[model samples]
Target: MNTYLRILSYARPYSRFVPVYIVYTLMAIIFGLLNFTLLKPLFDVIFEQVDSEVLLSYQNKPDFTFSIDYFTHLFNYYFLQVAEEYGKMGTLFYVCLIIVVSVFLANLFTYLSGVVLAKVRAVVIKRMRTDIFDQVSRLHIGYFSSERKGDLMSKMTNDVQEVENTIVQSLRVVFREPATIILYFAVLFFMSVKLTLFTILIIPISGAIIGGITRRLKKKAVESQQSLGRIVNILDETLGGMRVIKAFNAEWFMARKFDEETDHYAAVNVNMARKNELASPISQFLGVTVVAGILVYGGSLVLSGESTLGASDFITYIIIFTQVLNPAKEISRAVSNIQRGIASADRIFQVIDTKSKITDPDTPLAFDSFQKEIKFEQVSFGYEDEMVIKEVSFTLSKGKTIALVGPSGGGKSTLADLVPRFYDPTHGIISIDGHDLKELSLADLRKHMGIVTQESILFNDTVFNNIAFGMDEVSEEDVMEAAKIANAHGFISEMEHGYQTNIGERGAKLSGGQKQRLSIARAILKNPAILILDEATSALDSESELLVQEALTKLMQNRTTLVIAHRLSTIQHADEILVVEKGRIIQRGTHTDLMQQEGMYQKLSSIQSV
Candidate 1:
């Protein structure tokens, strides 16, 4: 229920449609009742030989009492009256005709209302998907490092679709179906409240049973959704590393692993469906029994001739009762769907509700230009368990490059991430030009730093758009200049579409060298005051490395740069080199000086040379 309330809050912006939807719902109900109510009179006129004066008067009456109401009702009366005039065969003909017309009009308006309701659902779901994407984009970087890409995709795709289905079904029941139950009950009650009361008693008992079953189904549904997310995550890992799996001959192993997760999903689904599927058949069975009980009791009452119910009235009750059955069944089915939607909602809301670990301070410093220095004062961090950076500190003078060289698990990358506030320091502080990093707006802080990681990030988009990603309203000339500096323009010009060529998903269509050059070009285009290069040239061959290195030198000039590289040769000429081990800075000096000191840096550099 709480989950549904949260989902409905999104519809607040479209509240104007609520009244319009209600009006349409009422019209559908009125038409449905007219469709059923016409049945009994036709039966009576044929079998009981009813009065012709009454039938003819109803056929042509201009009484203020009936009004035109609409052509459907008027035609319904006319068709029934004609049957009364034309004998038994004519009654059957008109009866079939009325059924066809009512069925047609009922279906026509139902379809129209469904289309309108779909529009409402589409708008709501679109807004929700947009909001979820925006939240994912804005979250702190650390979250993605620990989060599974496929699980997040499931939330956006599968989970949201579940919610959409529930909304569509719930609207039909909440709006249209309730109106049906009420209209039919009013007709039944006017005919005989004792019969109505009997049905009411039967309905609540069936509902109670369905409702209890639905609650258990909801628990199983939540488990099933989580299991499905795990399956997606495993499949993503398997497909993403198919090459590695084949090299190790692990196809059958992965297939077994996938089957395990899929089997768990199946088990949970079976549990949930066992309960939910019970609602429809049980309600149908109960409806049959109730109708039978009513018929037996109603017949006796009419035969006793002690009440208002005659043969016509008894037949009307049966018609209303049969019609009421469907709405009752629908309401139970809708409740089951609502429970499933709530399960998906819980997971989606979990993502939406997470507080970003890194957030800008309430009152932030806005820097016009970065000049003096970027400083880390007693910084420390950890990824859950062991500390990765501990009480380490450094200062980068304006326009100087600082290289962080370290053994594996030495926190070199974690330290670079701090400049953009990707993860807040567990203790102490980091500042740019005397203002704390956390005290600057995240967007403004990131605007000053450009980063390139070991994995070259590229979207399936035109080369021009990739270069211009970090900037707003980048012109063609700006893209050309950045590509030129990055040494990417020459090769890009030779491509079929030049700057307009689409880089297929993650630049898969481009060569390794081409992708690296484009990454450099994108960074160069941003032209940030600070730059982080995490082994940016590690993936390229020697020739590609040489080309990328040349571009890196040009891009790094006049920018405060932090470089993390396993190839100590690349950072040998940096102004300063800090050798990290465990979570502390074990050595800090010029590369030549570190070599003279014969420390961890010297040992690693010697290993690389050998």
Candidate 2:
């Protein structure tokens, strides 16, 4: 219930809707009760059973004031006039007409109250979705690495949908049902004090029983939502890795995996349904038992001449008491459904409440442009306890290229990530133009650098939009010029939509070369002062490499570069080359200088030269 209220709290400043909704709900309740309450008088008028003493009491018009009885007395006064002026059949016609109007007004106000709740529902979902999405966006890159994309996707899409459909829709039952039960019970008590007290005795037993059924519901709900998330995860993986699955002939494997999750989900839901579906019937059966008891007890009191109710009044009392059971049954069902919604709500808040490890300093240093160099002084980093990058010191000076060439499992990519403050070093300092990386705002620091990795991270967007991604003030001419420099403009022009052509997911519509070139064009569009190329041309064929290498050469001119090269020939002319092995720089020198040394660099260079 606390979780339910918290979800609703997203719609703040209740002044806009709460007061108006209350007014509508109250009016609806008043008119609906009037429809049932008039049955006694309706019976009397139809049977012509009004005694002279009772009719005389209503002869004088009751004065109106701020009380429930004022309306009742005023109504009876007019009813007496109708009985006197018209015949019994005419009075019966008048009572039925009053009931028809009351029913109409009741339904009209109920709809208005539902409209107010709908407005609250819309605002609540909009704000909650916006907040969760914003929180995900603010999380650091590491968070994505540690969490499953499918689970996060489920929280954003499926979990939010459940909250809206189940919990938000239950708002009427939460407010209106209780108010209805209270109002009905008040009328029942007014009708017979002894009978109402007997009925009230069954409440605690009903509450305890309903509470027991819903208690297990929350645990089952959490399990079911989690199982659904796993199913989605499997589906996502199967779709993304379909080629691998087919090549390995693992169709049966994936199918079995999917079946296991779905089977578990089915079982969980079936068990939950058993308990949830039982609540209403139990409440109804208990209500009927009470009604039977009331028949024996209350009817005996009237028959023995101890009770004040006439035959018609006693019957009306039973009718109003039966109405109370509907709202009670509705509340029981609402509690069952709400347990599931709160489980989903907990998943959503879990993501929204996570704190990002990477954030700007309280007093961040202003960094507008690159100067002298990027210096790594005794810098080391690791994941958990095992170090990935040992103490590696290097300087990438202005307008010079510093290349890192090494075998696989070396800390090449991790070293490049440090420059953008993607992850801070575990020990020592990485300074840009003498400012510690931590002191500078991440956006300001990254603005001067552009990175292109081995895998071209292209989105399912138009070629123009992909090239101009994350960059502002770029005109069409700018995108075209960047593409031309990266050797992508020719193919783009030949395509059906030119720059507007949609590159399917990860540029699947284009060849590997075309995708790499498009990614290069994006880097060229940024035109940063510092460039980090991590084996950008390694994945391309010889023909594609020549074109992309030429583009890289043009991009490298007059810029500080940190290059992680796989091909030895590509970095032969670098200002300095650091040959890394097992997270250590084992050899360092220029192309000609390293060729003279008898070490790992010479061995690697000799093998490639062969």
Candidate 3:
């Protein structure tokens, strides 16, 4: 319930509509009661037992509003006069007409209330989804490392829809069913408190039972929702890596894994459903018991002549008591639904409550230029338990290219990530132009750096948009110029739609080398002072590599470049080359100097040459 209240806070801006909805809902309930109330009098007149003196007293006896008083007085007066002249049968015909009119009005207002609720719920769903998406986007990259894509998708889609259903349905229950119960209770009490009180005894006992069931339902619902997320996660993983599974011929293995997860989800749902389904029959059975008790107890009173239970009043009382069954059943069902909704809300808000690990400073530094050298002094770092870089140090003087040659787990990429502040160094400091990297604003620090990684990620957007991705707005000429630098312009222009072509999902429509070139073009468009290339030509063929390498050489000529290269030939001409081994710089100098040293670099170059 607390989780739901937190979610409902999203509706604060639309508070005005809530009051309007509440009022209409209450009016609808009132109209329903009025429709029922007319039945007693209508039945009385029909039996020909309604005396004129009693009818006259009811007409004149009101310290209520003038309209209500006038209507009561006029209705009774006309009814008695008509009853005397036209007989009981004619009064019955008029009574049925009045009921039909009341029923029509009641349904009209109920429909209006539904419309209002739908509009409010749509706005709430939209707002909640947008907030969740925005929050996920701002979360640190580390959060994604252990998180399942499918679980996140489930939260965004299935969980949100559940919450929307809960909100709208719960609002309806709160406004309608409870009001129905209250209105009927008041009418029954006015009819006879002794009878009403006896029926009302079911309220507390039923509430306690419903309360206990709802608590367990909330717990079960949370478990079921979590299991659903797990199932979604399994499906996401299977689909994302289906190519690998097929290559490995592990279809049976994957099927078994999926079945295991789905079975868990099924068990959880069965438990949740069993608990939720308990609400209806349990409440109804109890209601029936209460009704039977009333029949026995109230029947004794009437037989003993201790109470005035007229045939018409007794009939009306029974009608009102039976109506109580609907409210009880509805409310009992609503409690379970509310519990499920709250469980989902709890999951959603858990995501919303997570504060991003990285955030901008209060007074951020503004820098439009990288005027001096990039320096790392005794930099040490770890990803949690394992130290990846130890006492590592380097200096990239302005306008020089440094190549890092290392084995697969030699912390080369980790060092590269620190430059862009993807993860800050665990110990020691990195500086740019004599200013600590942390002191400068994140936007300012990253703005001057261009990075092209091994995996060239591109969106399902036009070629021109992909090329000009980093800039706020770029001219066609500027996009073309960047493409030409990456040697992608020739191929792009030859495509069917040229730059306007929509690249399919994750640029799957393009060849691997073409995708890399587009990423290069995007970086080129940014025109950063510092460039970092992590195996930029690893995926390119010999022919594409030649063109991209030449473009890259020209791009690196006047910029401070850090190249993490696997192919020794790519970085033989670098101003300096460092051989990293086991998180330390074991050897450093120009390529020729490192080769003569007969160390890790020499062995790596020999292996590549062979």
Q: Give all candidates' CA lDDT scores.
A: 0.83, 0.91, 0.83
TM-score of each: 0.91, 0.97, 0.93
Among all windows of 10 consecutive residues in model 1, the one with the lowest summed lDDT is: 63-72
Model 3: per-residue Cα lDDT over 169-214, one tens digit each: 6777876887888878877887788988877776689778877887
Report clashes for each candidate as comma-separated counts: 0, 0, 0
Give per-residue CA lDDT, model 1, range 255-330, as digits (tens).
Answer: 9999999999998888888888898999899889889988887788788986677787688779778988898898
TM-score of the candidate numbered 3? 0.93
Residue 211 in model 1: lDDT: 81
Total backbone collisions, model 2? 0
Best by TM-score: 2
Worst 10 residues of 3 by lDDT: 59-68
**How far is 585's C-alpha from truth in model 3 (Å)?**
2.0
Off by over 4 Å in 1: 48-105
Which pairs, if any, clash in model 1? none
Q: Which digits, one per residue and each the tens of the lDDT, describe model 2 over residues 1-610?
A: 5787789798788899899999999999989999999999998866767887977888888776987688777888888888788968778888999999999999999999999999999999999899999999988887888888888888898899989988998999978999999999888877888888988886668878998999999999999889888988999999999999999999999999999999999999999999999999998988898788888889999899888888888999999988888988888999999999999999999999899877899999888888799999999998779899999999889999999998998999889989998888999899989999999988899899899999999999999999999988889999999999998899999999999999998899998889989988999999999999999999999999999999899888888999999999999989999999888899999989998989988888788879
Q: Pick the candidate with the highest lDDT.
A: 2
Please estimate how well model 2 matches the true structure, expressed as its whole-model Cα lDDT.
0.91
